[model samples]
Target: MNRREFVRWSGLGMMSLLLSGCGILGTSAGAAGEEVQKNSVSGGNKMKIVVINSSPHARDESTSIYLSDRFSAGAVSAGHQVFTFDGANEETHPCRGCDICHMNGPCVFSDAIENKLMPELLSADMIVLVTPLYYYGMSAQLKTVIDRFYSRTGMLHGKKSMLIATAYDSADWTMTALSEHYATLVRYMDWVDVGQVLGIGCGSRSLVEKSSFGEQAYNIGANL
Candidate 1:
């Protein structure tokens, strides 16, 4: 099917599953027919994961990128299909406050969301947002994508989500505001908040590489 058709059908399928009381969005079955705990990756079922890497650096020079890579590695090791999107590089347009999406179907804009993100998002079992802290908040690039999500309101409920935030400051409050915003988003979307990994005191790429945050991120991915 074409991308748009795929997205439409996927949304419909998700709604059907939800109404029928199936637990595909979060639960899985263990080998012995036991129920796998939510957010646990022990079962052999392969999850569809979408990683939104919002760091501006193209290389592994940023802590956010480094940690996200580690998470992706762990998820891959557990046999999950992971798709990473470079938010900084995507040509995403800001939402124009028009309610065209509500009147029609998804967003009316012919941008990355229509051509790319929406399809993957509709089909993803989990979403990982990786961002470098900017002014005690998420990057504008990532925020733009979040704003565009308005087009798919009521279509993304129950999806699991995780967050990874990196910052140079070592203070306890380094990412407090951003974490609050992330929590608000999770609540608004009615998605599960799997976890959040904070990589603090990462002044340089080498420091992040040497920090325990990488291992923590990897664990989160593996346990997803």
Candidate 2:
């Protein structure tokens, strides 16, 4: 579906879900019943997806933000629960190579990773990493999160992964290194590589606003 149509549909779906517990769905049992019905219809538990958006820009104009939003919309529409993290805004401590986490214990830092992200990572069925390309590689903020994953060793194994990268350069080569790195990381974690979406030539917010990358991102999430 096109971006506009997807957005409209998603909005309507969200409204329906939100109102399902408010007597709008003609159910007296409230939201709890709605959830059970949904799970029953699906015949299994809904997938839990964690999306880590590592773009430094806090505004919606960033290409990474746009793609991540679209992906989240699609995933929610597909009955999956999505937890998103703004890596740049989060209080994540850099991995100090203290080798403390390697001892099968938590990292020494008492930051967001230990208090919040580790639980999400361990419970997620799928993980999506969204970042802006920096010097033909993932952003340092995102790299920090990846590095911190060392603390979890086997916690993330066998999960599904997707990468969405945006770059200012028009050439596809600009994202090659980042893509390879993501692939290697997925392999090392024993996670399946679901897909990768690269947004190129997005030097200006206007270019990204006018591109089909958002629709592609939505489709990726929908199909996942």
- The lDDT for every candidate, in the order shown, is 0.74, 0.73
Per-residue CA lDDT of model 2 for 1-224, tens digit only, reads 23243234334333433332232111122323345444432223578999998987865677888888988887687678999888888899888877756524488988887777878988998888999999999999999988887677556666777888888898748888998787667655666666777899876678887888887778656554
| Candidate 2: Cα lDDT at 194 | 61
lDDT of 1 by residue, 194-223 (tens): 778888898689889989888888866665
Model 2 segments more than 4 A misplaced? 1-45
Model 1 has an lDDT value of 0.74
Q: Which ten residues in a row are the worst by lDDT in model 2?
A: 20-29
User: What residue pairs are clashing in model 1?
Assistant: none
Residue 182 of model 2, lDDT score? 79
Highest lDDT, which number?
1
Query: What TM-score would every model get versus the actual structure?
Result: 0.81, 0.78
TM-score of 2: 0.78
Off by more than 4 A, model 1? 1-44
